[model samples]
Target: MNRKRTALSAAAAGTTAGVVGLVLIAAPAGADTTPPALPETTAESLVASVLTTDVPALSGTVAVSSDLGLPIPGLPTGDEAARIYTDGEGKARVSLIEGDGEKTLVADGATTWLWSSADKSVVKYTGGARDKAGEEQRLTDPAAAAREFVTAMGDESTLSVDGTARVADRPVYQLVVTPKPSERTLLREVRISVDSETRVPLRLEVLANGSAAPALSLGFTEFTPGAQDASLFTFTPPAGAKVTDGNAEVGKHEPTEQQKQDLLNAIKPKVVGSGWDTVYVGTVPADLLESEVTTEDKGGREGGKTTGLDLVKQFGQPVSGAFGTGTVITTKVGTALVTDDGQVAVGAVPQQVLVDALGQK
Candidate 1:
């Protein structure tokens, strides 16, 4: 529903890809059942059943890809492994292993934490934290996380029986979900594979208009439900690790009028030539331009000044990925770097923030 919540879903979807890949290998193949008996269940009812079922605790890997139809610059395409455990109390722990290090994202029903192994740091946020902070943030509850898929189901009436399939050796019913007539978006249809016996969704495929390929697909592997320890909902920061309370930080940092003006002033003239130019105090200095270019590693033999200018023209805006490429930048008034495609930029101010500052004059 919210951007942060959407991001959490995207992150979870990305992580679930790896898990699906591992479990898909064990899935069985068979001819499509002609007009298989579709379950007479509503999307809400089906989702509720999955949440309450005594399924086994799930653990597996996932891979993700976004920006399906459109081409976005600096986005990485790869697979990430994830392991998830749910205790049916609207709580879950998901650990994602990407490359050499692991990132642990947990929702203890109340708060969410994204722990990075490389930095050994944890960024914590609660549901209400974003509201008090007046910023978008991620959802931490396991049920809330799963609801992303259910919400995306669009119109309930568009759902229809597709066929039968097997996921992780379990027979599943394939149901095609389409957008409601009232809904207007690029998304055309979504196909969900549900466990035939349990009626829980095993996989979801999103198809977009004008695209031959489905935009995104996510699958849940090793589905299980049982009594889980209460400790699963609690997180103890690692030894010597810095704990950041996102709520406190948001409360402490309120931009002043001058600060806002400065940010606005920083972005003026929007278009500066590729080469360096020294503007006045109110103007973006040529050296500052060079610095921006150099910092992004987009400079050329002459330090990429011309190349940076070309990029500006191509993007029709000042492109800043100072944090990294995959990071999504969203801002209320300033720029925020998304570390991963789904991670919200917490403390870091985006390049636009400086641009806005320069525009103040």
Candidate 2:
């Protein structure tokens, strides 16, 4: 839900496409039963409904299954489940079950807490009324995820309602989105099941080219819309848990306009190409390029540490072109090129697409 963390995890694990794919290709799969018949609605009206629908107070369990075919150090693979709770206002809580522990996040008004049972660590963040950290967490929800994708995929995509099905016991209209013929992407099509009554999305599925089964899917197995208990959004760090102030120096000083722009420029990646084949070009911190990620008892590799550059080199193949030489990491739905000079070009496109992206000034 943290955009910065998502980007870092994607870069560290060579899952750029997987992370980005979650947003760009959000949808749902079909149910095995006979398709349900729902009142006819145009794709435009369905998309409009998702955009206008205000999320109600609810709690649900999300089942996530990903087959990116790429390994991210320190992360578990295969199917995983997460619990979500929201008060329909500005308060929310999410709990994710890890291998032997749990990670819980709660956002109560201006304060947000992230507790990790694995490390016995707690991080607290405080911001003003406009702070959207909690709202962004909604992206993990099927409804919110599908809403974002529908909003962004307009014009360049073809939208249609193929049929209807039941998701989470609620009848839903199946809205399908596919890239136009001009867009070159590894993905096939996205299927989203929107609730017929409330118009909220209930499930989403993404299929990659040449894959009959969904390459990635996230949807609610259970959903209840109502007022959540107030206690769910409140949090207090456990005794002896390490506490870190996520925004300790928030109001300590004001940055100059130039300084603010400079920082933004440094963090924002340069966009190359467009549509589903869009590439993001950015510079990795010099120190990070020399950094190493260590894992303990993971996949029979005990206490193994790999540097950033070494990581790409080990997982990628040597590649060179007009943009110069680099190592390219390829997966089922994406590719990433890490040049020797700490520059990275990542996208859901092919290796040559990455090369061409970098070739442009």
Candidate 3:
């Protein structure tokens, strides 16, 4: 088998509307005003409106805060900011602030660029080659995540309006998604802040079971909705920056578009189960795992016998079950399991749900 790296890695990073966020300063201690009146719609109607609402082209700053205690390398933690811009044509840009460095993502029509200021490296992709409009579309980011749950409501999840509040100084409705009694998940609720006038999702908060705080939160700290410049969606490698095609294979040839589609169709994973307890399973090639571990070793102490799971457990708790011993890593928003038999399961449910998922084979 010819080993090849597809553009799957870039799919998650592609749909970002390149919007960087600005930090808001606190107002005077005595400043106060009555919050706007609550919206006059039931949760179901509000959710329906949100799903069908087409957010206008605009640029704004978004804040992402996560307490998911995963040791996943390169996972951004704490309260970080990003500037997101969208042109209403599915073209968007995201500039992420990472301390003194920044990582920018610009997604044009059929191409995307990932640039890192720290390393001065650029990775270009050939767009979302998989079923992006389906399973993968929901993971675009936190703001989009709220829209996803709203669209996915009505069946496995119960939708209700948790009333209204002012977020980012705008009056909005709080749409909440609560898992049904039969749904096995750790999430207590997923709250979406929808701009009352625009019906666009302004923020999302994911709260774990029995937790008072959000495990994962994403929303605009400030928003200025309007037409964005055309330049935000375009990118050119800066002078002296290294560039690499995302679909470049190991051999001397580049994979054609048809080849990329074929590769995606070949390895397309299947989703087993439903609702919050869903599991994604696919047969990833051995070289993919090998390359992943090798990359990790390049950063850690040389000659460590540990593979990906070993390194993952260093930051998570050790877990074992009949589904075969593997580490279970839990974030504030969800939990995941990496089985010894090369099967992986992730969701907001507890570790046992993953064990059950691994047994489905």
Candidate 4:
């Protein structure tokens, strides 16, 4: 979930136009002086002008390099190229193809879906209200997107000054966007390049903070405006695909008290020996463990109980359950099953299997 959330936030922030403001700073030496004056524009006006521009539908290829402070534990460096398309209304789609595997994401005006070709699964998000509210907050609220621009130039963000350099042969306006100090992520500053003549943003660079790497850049290529079709926004679940509604209740199941105790016993040794001082356990996989059994909870009259398992631990590494493939993490006593909730679950998997899997490393 953290990985998914991070990717989605990065993608959304990358494509959204209203967060950053265009400001006219003095051009560097030997730049074109004939370009229009940039100082007269305000942040709000610049955002409005870009949003209202009637560009044709667009198609492009984008390359993204994600450095999450450290390398992904199991995956590669996480650099990949994706096909991207955007309509004039801020709707965008991105698809990544690698060998026989693919991942697709569509952000229509109202909803966003993340589709995994390998799993034949889709994660849907309703974004119409969210986008609108986010837009308003970005434009009007002091702590929203592009809050950095609000602090640096305030109302002057709308003013556009000619940039000193040309990217992709188009005249560029260097725009600086600053996120609020209290923003959720580590993003410190963003620099975007907007077309001087068309007022459309072409490129963006984000600078972060800490030992966690500081900078990541995204460049848009082969931009074509107003060329996308409306049908691209819709998605149909594939045949035999399992559908999960994110907004729905996660469902609950009841397990016997004895089964719960057995489950705790199975994981207790692993937790005690886990090097970490604190751990959170939730949603354990019960199928693989003999000591634990998952049964439906019959707490209420509506007795269609869902199946789930829970184990608590004070020390272990955080683990996620979203990975369809199970992962074993080393602990002080031995190895433990790290569940989808970043928790260590005892009896979620056989202790021997956990040790074997960890030993493979």
TM-score of candidate 1 versus the correct structure, residues matched by position: 0.51
Candidate 4 has its poorest 10 consecutive residues by lDDT at 136-145
Clashes of each: 38, 5, 15, 23
Could you say which candidate leads in TM-score? Answer: 2
Better of 1 and 3 by TM-score: 3
TM-score of each: 0.51, 0.78, 0.71, 0.41
Question: With candidate 1 superimposed using the best TM-score fit, by how many Å does residue 327's alpha carbon deviate from the native?
Answer: 22
lDDT of each: 0.51, 0.81, 0.71, 0.49
> How would you order the candidates by lDDT, starting with the best?
2, 3, 1, 4
lDDT of 2: 0.81
lDDT of 1 by residue, 179-282 (tens): 56544334566667777675556666667656656566556544454566667668878889988887777667878889878765663333321111111122
Which candidate comes out best when scored by lDDT? 2
Question: 1-361, model 2: which lDDT tens digit per residue?
Answer: 6999988887877776677768555654433578777889999999999889887898988887878778755333578788999887878898988889998989988789989999999978887622444543565688778887887778789999988888887788989999898887888888998888877788899888898888778888878888999999999998999998766544445577898887667655799977788999987777788987774564666677878788779888998887677899887778889989878999888788888888887
lDDT of 4 at 11: 89
The TM-score, computed over Cα atoms with residue i paired to residue i, of candidate 3 is 0.71
**TM-score of candidate 2 relative to the true fold:** 0.78
lDDT string, candidate 3, 1-361, tens digits: 1232345445434534222111113453223346578648988788778788887887778887877765456554677788878887778887877779998888887877778999999877774531222222233355567765666655788888877777777788888888898988888888898999888898898898877988888887777778988988899999999987764522336577899887666555668778877766554444443443543353455564555655656656777877767777887667777665555677778877777777776
**What ranking emerges by TM-score with the best candidate at the front?**
2, 3, 1, 4
* Candidate 4: segments with Cα more than 4 A from true spot: 1-56, 66-78, 98-100, 107-112, 125-164, 176-190, 207-214, 249-361
